[model samples]
Target chain A: MNRNRSVFLLSALVFGFAFLYVPIISMIVFSFNESKLVTVWGGFSVKWYGELFHNRRMLEAAWLSVRIAAVSATCAVIIGTMAGFALARFGHFRTRTLFSGMVTAPLVMPEVITGLSLLLLFVALAPLPFIPDTRGFSTITIAHITLTMSYVAVIVQSRLSSMDDSLEEAALDLGARPWKVFMVITLPIIAPAMISGWLLAFTLSLDDLVIASFTAGPSTNTLPMMIFSTVRRGITPEINALATIMVGIVTIFVITAGVLMARQERRRQLETRGAGR
Target chain B: MANPSYVTLGQRILAGLDKALTTVMASPPYRWSQGILRRAGVTGRTLVIAVPWVWLLIFFLIPFIIVFKISFAETRWLGSPPYAPIWEWVEGHALHVKITFANYLFLLSDSLYVQAFLSSLKVASVSTILCLLLGYPMAYGIARADPSWRNTLLLLVILPFWTSFLLRVYAWMGLLNNHGVINQFLMWTGIIDEPIVMLQTDFAMYIGIVYSYLPFMILPLYSNLEKHDPTLLEAAVDLGCRPFRAFLSITLPLSKPGIIAGSMLVFIPAVGEFVIPRLLGGTDSLMIGRVLWDEYFLNRNWPVASAVAIALLLLLVIPIVIFQRYQLQEASGEQQR
Candidate 1:
């Protein structure tokens, strides 16, 4: 709380923010550059945005990524919620340690190893009637579900553990079935965690490049894969335009989520203070 | 009989089925079914546990097994499956299965693979230290800020993470390229006579890794630092301890778990980081992730690639195991409290 310490802290924060945001802001500014060259600043123009709009390949890839992320996030939430419930509620099952370890493994697993192993699994199982023949949308979705569900489970587990369990116990004691208790009482309480988990999964799926690259077929190109391949060739104004649009969309979502969470926290604090009074 | 006549058809069917079920339950063969019926709660819990368990075992654990098995198999040039089967039975005859340790042996014998592994460790370790030094101050700042401003500050820290990671790296490309903004600015300001060669260098790779993984470091540290009781620091001050001394003795020691968790999170993935080194590093930058990619995709050597991956997994297992143990200990410690 000292003045000198505060000054130092403030400067550190400023430097950190600058490090994080400068490149992103520059990219956004250059997206509208009239000059074909990225570094050279010609007068602002919307031509690259037009080019981005007209690029069919980019559009399709982006749309495909959205669909994959959506489906994968939903599936991850459902499975993760179940896993989280088991971890928090079931005291000590037979395979508890193994279950927890498996659920948390993907959090630290390298993308390349994960991608390769999953690819190998799919190929080995391709002969089965239930398994699909080619790696594409479904394969990517399955891989993503495996990847993101671990994150969701961890999030949901922590939320559940910190939550008071009296409401759930009361419901059960009042003759409600366990399933009914969970559905009516626990689900609503854990809904925020579930939503956050879904958002995390969605963004993770959306941002992934390495795993998608390995798992995707020749025909199935996610947006990150497209951007990576294009960037490998060279920087293009079209990419800058695309990236700017992505940044805008993600920023809106993040701000909305942040506002909602902060408001919820404030309300909870007020309620506690009122009770104390 | 009069009651039966008055009864609805649905009620009659239910009554009949109920009677039949009771009759079946009376039989010795159905005793286990009756027990299960009595323990419906256990059944439900079991179902909840079973579904995700089976899914992870199939999709997560089984793949690792497959990778492990493939790593031991021989590479076959002329096969539909690429890798020769570990065990094969020919017509009425069993051919001995040939499992090769050669791929792993090859990895050991070849200096290229060993160098890549060592260099990857070096790069990942150095980047992790840099992230800690940079992240610690920011985390401390956020943790010490006014309560009203803390949420907004944390949100700012996480905002860049939501954007496409590849785009963030690409933005760096535009900045670090010889003809890019950084160079342009220096020339314009008369700081340099010419644009320095910055792209495709170790410096660029470090920047990319640090930029990408900084949030991973800060969030954990912030969570840890935020929970410290302010009274402890005040007590230290009352004891005539210098502020810096208090921080080093009290705050830093308390934040050890956070430091470890964050560093592990950053370090493990950074070791096998394919994208950053590939995009930002030059030809001399032969990180293991890139080596694995080339071995699999470029050289068309599945077995060797699998071996590299398995080796990487083995190297990583020690830290992961240690971290898991720490987590388990912490969880139990909390429960005890």
Candidate 2:
């Protein structure tokens, strides 16, 4: 590309990044504003942060959100890993097309539809003995898993597909059973993918407001639901404070992970290069 | 290798477990069960497929079926399910199927539902185009950036995605509200005499969807662009093709899959978007998702809400199938490569 085109491209990127970050940055900046009005630039204060911590409902909701996210992510990773392994290794089964359809459909299915459908399912099956009559933690968690497992399946499937099979084959050749080979060889190699998938699933579950709103019982108010209800009331500095904390935690975690991964990758490259000589 | 000369504790334990597992598998009872299962063609492969498959069948697939069924049932306000059963056993145990199209008829007769569906489609399509236009250059720049900087740029694109979607939409409220940042800044700069109503408008809703879903667009496009062979561009240049022309002829054509994938990612969800429209758009803005939410929560009309969801799913079937086809093809392409 020409230098002019390159400059234009760089500017476009700058503009895009600015567009993405300015809203978030404004939220962070306003979180510290002492004034009740969000528009006015009152002198900076940490009062909202303090208030956010003391707010028992918000804290409880946050804790509930975390619990739901953790449980859903763990379950999704287990089921999704199995799904991914089957897709990559099982070579076309009898119902492969239908199975694939069910797995991929959720990834793009709109949240409202997923939420409504699940709520309907819960209500429809209410009369059954095994089914819970009241929608609660389990219902919401199951709804989250249906959405998040698709994501995990996609992530793990990609990793498994690109993975070399020589180590697995060699293990099997050396008197190891197929299951043993998988446990020792395949699992470790795909562990990183699974970890990342778990994180993705956890965040998605935590961030969800719509699906949980539909499936949550009267008592099960998650963080996003709380935020949504509060938002409907109007702009509140406490929401800003909460947003700041969430963005801060996620940013720190992601950057630290990225840096560590990059360093490890570079070291591996260096080792390989050194051994090549 | 277990390295017999120097067996580590980990290796020893692994070996011991493997041996124990093999012994257990060889035992008569285990062998008998295995033989029976094998004779029935129920192997580990089938077992792996059974779990996630059955889970999706119940939770994902079956829920949609229930939604469809509920949509056909009449509303009954005084029950756990505020909708009447689609079928019920009455005297003598003969099968009874009571399927009503009343909900669907209500949807069709009222222009509101139809208008909401159309408006949602329009909004989703327009926002998808906006995302593509805005995201393409950013993806290209990052894809062509120095190797060392690529990861950071890509991370920057995806970082917003990891944050709360609701929070991001909420953050935009701080920017676009009447007295929000943009209006304040514009008024201060003398760009306008009065605060232009930025929030609670179609424009604000567009901004919300594009801002929220842009990462989804860029990531796929960037991954596709990043894999394009640089040598091809060099060759085109050597052959005296103009820079922009080369981009159009070589780069754009090559990234069709990415474009489709990214567009589907944005478009599919944007159609049923509730929070963005309800939170950002005016009360006048009609989206199927918001309409459905209102139907269920405000009106306490479960059958109507179910009908709306069924309609939205029907609308989405085409795009969802396209996306599935693309993903499967992409997977196969990767394996072939």
> Over the stretch B1-337, how does candidate 2's per-residue lDDT look in tens digits?
3224444454466667767987898899999999999999998877888999899988988888888888899999887567788778889978788999999999999999999999999999999999999999999999999998999999999899999999999998889988999989999999998999988999999999999999999998998999999899889999999988999999999999999999999999999999999899998999999999999888889889989998998899899999999999977777676
Local accuracy of candidate 1 as per-residue lDDT tens digits, B1-337 = 2223434443455456656766775798777874776577557788789889999999999999999999999999778678999988787877878799989999999999999999999999999999999999999999999998998999999999888889999999999999999999999999998999989999999999999999999998998899899999999999999888899999999999889888988899999999999889997898999999999888878999999999999989987886676556655544444
Give the CAPRI class of candidate 1: acceptable
lDDT of each: 0.89, 0.90
Model 1 ranges with Cα > 4 A deviation = A271-277, B1-42, B329-337
lDDT assessment of candidate 2: 0.90
Models, CA RMSD each = 7.7, 3.1
Worst 10 residues of 2 chain A by lDDT: A263-272
lDDT of 1 at A269: 78
What are the runs in model 2 whose C-alpha is more than 4 Å off? Answer: A270-277, B1-41
Expressed as tens digits, the lDDT of each residue in A184-252 for candidate 2 is 778766877887899999999999999999998888899999999999877899999999999999999
Best model per TM-score: 2
